[model samples]
Target: MRGFAQLLSGFLLEYVPRRRSLSENTAKSYRDSFAILLRWLADGRGIAPDDVRIEDLSRENVESFCLWLSDVRGVCAATVNVRLCALRSFASYVSFTEPAYLEWASALRAVEFSKSPSGEVEWLPVEAVNLIMESASSDAREHAMLGLLYDSGARVSEIANARRCDLRLDAPATIRLSGKGRKVRIVPLCDQVAGMASAYLAATAGAPDSPLFVNRSGKAIGRAGITYVLKKHVAAAHEADPLVVPPTTHPHALRHSKAVHLVEADVNIIYIRDFMGHSSVKTTEIYAKISSKSRQKAVEKAAANLIMGSAYGEEDKSAIMEWLRNLL
Candidate 1:
């Protein structure tokens, strides 16, 4: 049985030998994506890569594959979408390279994929943030770690890999994060976050190029460390409340809260994109729903305030009180 690579090499060598290499990153992405696809085809569908006919990727097969990803693998929608995208690439490849398979590839157009909702991220209220920040340990590390998330709105991967060199602490402070696909984006730090991070950096005992964040074990902070830091502080804050609220903590919520705060402040949407390292504005659209809800609440509060201060303020209130008394 021939491997998928062998088939591709044979076909390309026999026919389109003149095809130049695509961009290194693109070729790598395609290779990685398609390789997983071929493996899935052989293992899951019981079809050898060489024997995988164009019809192997029929609409039924595509739907079954998505189900298998969720049921068998327990993957989330975003992860499933990545694999589906790989299939689309294969379909696109088949369309041009193998005329016979064009219909099979085109049939993939009928397959529907559920997109992840933009509301996946939940931001806490600004009032709640004050409690969380205040709950941080006296340790500068804790302060800086928590502050950095709000200041940078960075993904977890970027935070784990953050280094001192990434910071540019002049006016309009910035830190560079190496994001997905090794893309670099500079996220400006607010003055408070910048100052906290600088103090933490100065207090840390490590090499200049060592991890910017460390845990109790004296190692660089990882996902678990980040979670631990957030949960403990959040629980403490929740316990301190006179209301005795239930503890609800999510790491990404801090990042989301930052985005929402900026949007509410009317920051330029494009600047938010650049700051957040969002490759597409669609990725940044998560705030639309949140902002709209907030706007409605603000308008309602403003209307209440206006009525309280208006000429009919007393008369209208008296009428409402009379109606309430009658109902009672």
Candidate 2:
């Protein structure tokens, strides 16, 4: 007989953080999902959010919410699936805590995840990445940020959350990145990037605990801010050469580009997985697949060009076939 508000508070404040040990970002995403759902119920079903009860979270209403998200809000399938997952997790939590709602939870869990397309991963070529870096070369802070972003292959959040103490500019320089699930990994930096980090740090000395990257206002740059910095450089690179930098270049593309480059260099898949902070090698295999496909296309194109350019006719083909048969 617990109210919806009471259950949601416990699920988000305690169960998600304490029991599940999820990160703040994940908790916030879940909270936003519920907020959207509650607003939908209030506006559509005329159910006041505060007056809503556990019984109001019926399977039909949950399914309708998914539809409304797609049709009205214009959200993508992946986003819809994330919202569904949040509700499913909340229902599961309720089932465990309040046995009386076990049936309700079961019904809610029956809701299917929205089907989402597995689109091709977008990445930039090495030349394009270098061009983007060159565009930011005039600004020391931007150059250092771009260097760490690509060399470390860290997500925007990981780079944004980095502290001054996380950097090591000594021999075999590396930076510590905190990834999802609060996992920390040390990623080595190339000599060029290491030097950039050293120079940038020396120019702007701060407390060891202070953020490694900060805005002009002396505040720690958030993920959006990092994206803005990247886009600004990307625009400059695009103006220099329209073909080099795509208009849609974003921060995650740098991470993907690093992974793709590693795959092309014949780096072991397991090593790439760990380097990219991927949870499994299966996730890392996508880069290998992309590289393989690119090679296949190149070989096919070369074979086609050779055949078309050659003067070989039926007589030339017969002679080649006879020579092959004799050798066999």
Candidate 3:
């Protein structure tokens, strides 16, 4: 019992952060999975979290928990898969401590990740993004943050962790964004975005180490803060032009919009992949697939430039037809 407590505490406190050095979001996800499992064990099995022995974490318990997540909590397949992944990771760690449970860890790991339904990638139109940016012009911080999200196509986490030192507003301005799995990438900023960032920073007058975007309390803006700014402006843009901005507009939609716009501009997909900090071109290809405007343009171009029949002359066509007739 004491050993189980030590294992859970050490895994969450030391192993995940110190050994794996995962991002805060990733750590929270792992912690959340354990918390949910603890709650389920207490509620469903009448077992307290700390009182549970290592033997209690059986293969049956894991599968039961997965079903509870889907049937009781009503979580999506992707979310269920995420919790399963966290459980599998913990099970593997347990194997290292208790060699006797090697088979148990293997059984838990054998559980398959559920398949999720494919859906169209949601992205805003150019006019919609423009309207949202215009709506945010009243607040320089919001404007700059929105512009940066669109221009750089950074994930919300990357934007939240941005610092004043990350910006380089000289000629050929760029910002360094740290993405998932601690991968850092340099994204070039457009002139408009660069100017906005410059003005906002100058007004804020923070040290290089200070957060780039702060809330009303002068504390660093979090993911929720960024989402709030985006949602507020999206509503305003919709009010101004109801048809332009969609109700589903989000900060990540700005990232998607930027990628789709780049694809529409005939930019090389590889460059877009690098610019967006995607690990693979396959991930970047979703934007090209979702760019209906670009696809329509391609169809129109092909239709407008149709060649009038084959280049063969009438005599050549006749001779071919005669040869075919004779052979028949």
Candidate 4:
């Protein structure tokens, strides 16, 4: 048990941050997974977290843990799979540090990830996005933040972590976003968004190193705070027209909207991939597929309207057919 505690500590504290060089968000996710697992074990088997032995992490227990996450906690398959991934990573670490648990690690690895359905990516249409932006016009910070989010296609964390020094408001304005794995990508800002950002910056002057967006208390805005800001404006937009924004709209929807708009503009897939900071073009391809579907729907609607609205009688149709034959 002491061995398990020490190794677990080292894996979470040292290996994850230093050796793996995972981002802070990922490290926190792993920590939360383990925390839930420990609490579950403590409740079910009456074993305190410190008293948990390495042997307790049998394949059966891990499977049951996943089931508990799904059935008891009402979490989805994707979330369960995330917890399983954390466990598998820890198991690999155990296998390397202590060869005696090699078989145990192998058993844990054998646990399968739960299959999750591929759901449609939720995104706002341009009109809806414009409505939401307009709804937040009263607040400069909210307006600028929404504009930046839609313009940059950055993950919420990247926006939350943005600093004043990262913005370049000169011609060809751009903002530097640090994404997963601490990779930095510079995304260009549109002139309208750039203007909004300029207004925001002038209103709230701070050190270059200070957070670009701050909460009312002058501290750096976190992911939750960002989400709150988005939701507040979404609610205002909803009041104007309930159909314009989904009730559960999140910040990621803006990112998706930006990608889909880029696809509609006939942007190159490679450029869109880099713009979205996606590691693979395959990730960007989803937007292309979405765009194709949207276009097909529009075309189908237009075709249906043209056919249904036409006032051609049987005689007129026959005349048109005869004309077509003659032309051919």
Model 1, span 241-282: residue lDDT tens:
412212556688788888898888889888888888888888
Give TM per candidate: 0.55, 0.58, 0.55, 0.59
Q: Please, what are the lDDT tens digits per residue for candidate 2 over residues 286-325?
A: 9998787666655654444546566787687566655644
Give the clashing pairs for model 1: none
Q: Identify the candidate with maximal TM-score.
A: 4
Question: What is the lDDT, from 0 to 100, of the residue 224 in candidate 2?
Answer: 90
lDDT of 4 by residue, 1-328 (tens): 2388998999999988889876676687789899999999999878899799988888999999999999998776656876887898899999998988999999999998776445868787897798899988888999999899999999999999999999999999999999999999999999999999999999988999999999989999998998998998877774344334444478998999999999999999999999999999999999999888777656554444446657886677666655644532
How many backbone overlaps does candidate 3 show?
Answer: 0
- Scored against the true structure, residue 319 in model 3 reaches a CA lDDT of 65
Model 4: lDDT to the true structure: 0.85
lDDT of each: 0.70, 0.85, 0.81, 0.85
> Ranking under TM-score, best-scoring first?
4, 2, 3, 1
Instruction: Give candidate 3 misplaced runs (Cα > 4 Å).
Output: 1-118, 292-294, 297-328
Using TM-score as the measure, name the better of candidate 2 and candidate 3. 2
* Alpha-carbon RMSD, candidate 3: 19.8
* Candidate ordering by lDDT (highest first): 4, 2, 3, 1
